[model samples]
Target: MPQTEHGANRRRGRDETEEERADRMWTDLIQEVRVAQTGVQILFGFLLTVVFTPKYAELSDTDQTIYIVTVVLGACATGALIGPVSLHRLVSGRRIKAQAVRWASRLTLLGLLLLLATTSAALLLILRVATHDGFVPYLVAGVVAWFLLCWFGLPLWTRHRHTVK
Candidate 1:
């Protein structure tokens, strides 16, 4: 069992060396990243095509700006989500899997945040274009709240509830 700096035993179940732990964590992170990467890549691809669409030329200035921001956010999210693979490929056999995993995890989290922003912006622009009503903002805000609750609030609550003191 490996003890933490505070002298708490840290083994999840079976005994694992640092390298073994890193390997397991890396595998898990990769699995999670695959799902996010696929979604972001698809969204980014669709965003890329929107600029070439005939309707894109008719959008108002504000909507065009929102579309640009959404597209940029989607691109950034795609990069961050795919970053872990590049990080692992470049750092493999460097005896730094643990550090690499940490950085990859950070990138994944940032990617998720960017994805959320991209989705929100896309939704806002779509509703504004389709409805042109004041209720668009309210609807967007409600959906954003739902997304926050599902993506961050629930996970944080579960982690805090289950973590040992």
Candidate 2:
């Protein structure tokens, strides 16, 4: 039994070493990235087709700008979500699982943030085109709030509340 720094058995039933822990974390991260990558890729694919639609020309200049920005953000999110695969392929068998996991986590975070922005912009553009109302900002704000809760607030709260010392 390995004594912990607090003079207790540190092993929590699974006596995984640092490398093994990193490998586990890496797999979990990859699974998470896969979910986000799939969503962003689908969204990016749809956004890419919007410009070819006849309705695109009917959009106001402001809405056109919003669509452009949203598409760009979606593209960025797609790239960020897929970055881990490229990173792993390039660094395969490099004996740097910990570093790779860290990088992948960073990329995933970036991807999520970009996804949030992309979704928000897309919602705003769609609502403005569909409603043409003065309350579009409020609608977009409410949707953004919901997204914040679902994507970030809940996860962070759970992590903080349940993480062991």
User: Which candidate has the highest lDDT of all?
Assistant: 1
Residues 67-126 of candidate 1: C-alpha lDDT, one tens digit per residue:
999999998999999999999999999999999999999999999999999999989998
Error of 2 at 18 (Å): 1.5
* lDDT assessment of candidate 1: 0.94
Scored by lDDT, model 2 comes in at 0.92
**Candidate 1 ranges beyond 4 A from true positions:** 1-14
Residue 133, model 1: lDDT of 89
Colliding pairs, model 1: none
Clashes of each: 0, 0
| Consecutive 10-residue window with the lowest summed lDDT within model 2 | 6-15
TM-score of each: 0.91, 0.90
